[model samples]
Target: MRRILAVLLIAATTASAAAAGQSGKPRYFVKAWLQKADKTFEHTTSWCGPDQHCLVPIGEDMIELRELSGSSYYLRFISASSEDTPCCVFRNGSREARLESEYPRVATLYYRPEIWGGRGVTKFGRLIIVVEDLY
Candidate 1:
């Protein structure tokens, strides 16, 4: 009886640990950019693929962009759905202007138009995101 009880306890502990790990949210890379005139431009196309896509929070979403100088920027939005499609926005200080939408799922070619001044080819860039499963 003692041996049986010990085995059951160990099994329970292992099951709990597995459950905890599964409950943790998964991390994903989200690529954001603009598309214009049937052209797409951006940097770091890690997450824009057929098997991979941007993961958005079920509720409110917050994204932070960190620069090489250690400075950061924040973007907050609600209802970022998978069916809503992907796009990029240009930032000018506190003002954010939407550039364009409708980008290829995984293609890494083409050039996205620059919405903030004639800054050559403006690639908004990529960001790592942790999305919570709000079932």
Candidate 2:
């Protein structure tokens, strides 16, 4: 039937994409930047405080991210298995780098109005300026 054909088509595409990538651990990254409430984009962490105008100052360990978390500047990566979906690192507020892959499929991005765009954070204090795809 049409449904079966469609399912086969999708599986074929995914297999093709997986094979195209290099022989290594499958991984991806997300990029974003930190913006002060003063409307200025701060590439590096500065005098940002947790309960002040800036919550993430320079050298602050951004362990907690949108969907990823770890120690200091680097995050942990978990490989995918046949029974589980692939994992990704949400590299938020990183303006210099972007996430890319040779694979044809990828994760979809969306805006979180209730979190950063709500009141504090970017609207009133500080925020991690992540693009739609980075979040």
Candidate 3:
């Protein structure tokens, strides 16, 4: 009985969140700025929502970032989905890696920091800076 209620509650919350995302409320955005070898930059940005996959392509790979309702966020690499290879990672402002791991990690930012960002590396060792905004 308790388990059923929990499942139902989660389902209801997710459905409402999906609706809110389409309602034009302040949504989360995942922006990427990839530096090329010639010093030029390639940019891409996508809005995120609960249970939705927002992909920003970098070279042949892609950085996947999404928000869970308005509560938390998730980050990972699409190409590295089935492998243990580290394709991307969240980092602090100082360029120090923060949420580094061999696999995807669900990041729950209850405090809603202004910026929860990350970086992606291409096959040529170029840099891709990805920023996830709280609002």
In terms of TM-score, which candidate is strongest? 3
Q: Which candidate's lDDT is highest?
A: 3
Identify the runs in model 2 with alpha carbons over 4 angstroms from their true place.
Answer: 1-26, 44-63, 66-135
User: Against the hidden true structure, what lDDT does model 1 obtain?
Assistant: 0.28
Residue pairs in steric clash, candidate 1? 40-111, 40-112, 41-112
Model 2, position 87, has a per-residue lDDT of 23
Lowest summed-lDDT stretch of 10 residues in model 2?
Answer: 45-54
Q: Count of backbone clashes for each model?
A: 3, 7, 0
Q: Candidate 2: TM-score?
A: 0.22
Q: List the candidates' TM-scores in order.
A: 0.18, 0.22, 0.35
When sorted by lDDT, best at the front, the candidate numbers are 3, 1, 2
Model 2: lDDT equals 0.27
Task: State in Å the error of residue 113, model 1.
Answer: 7.5
- What Cα-based lDDT does every candidate model obtain? 0.28, 0.27, 0.39
Off by over 4 Å in 3: 1-26, 37-40, 58-61, 66-74, 77-123, 126-130, 133-135
Can you rank all candidates by TM-score, best first?
3, 2, 1
**lDDT (Cα, tens digit) per residue for candidate 1, span 1-135:** 534533333333332222222233433233333223344322221221122223222123333322211122233322232533333443332322221122212212212343334555544343222222222
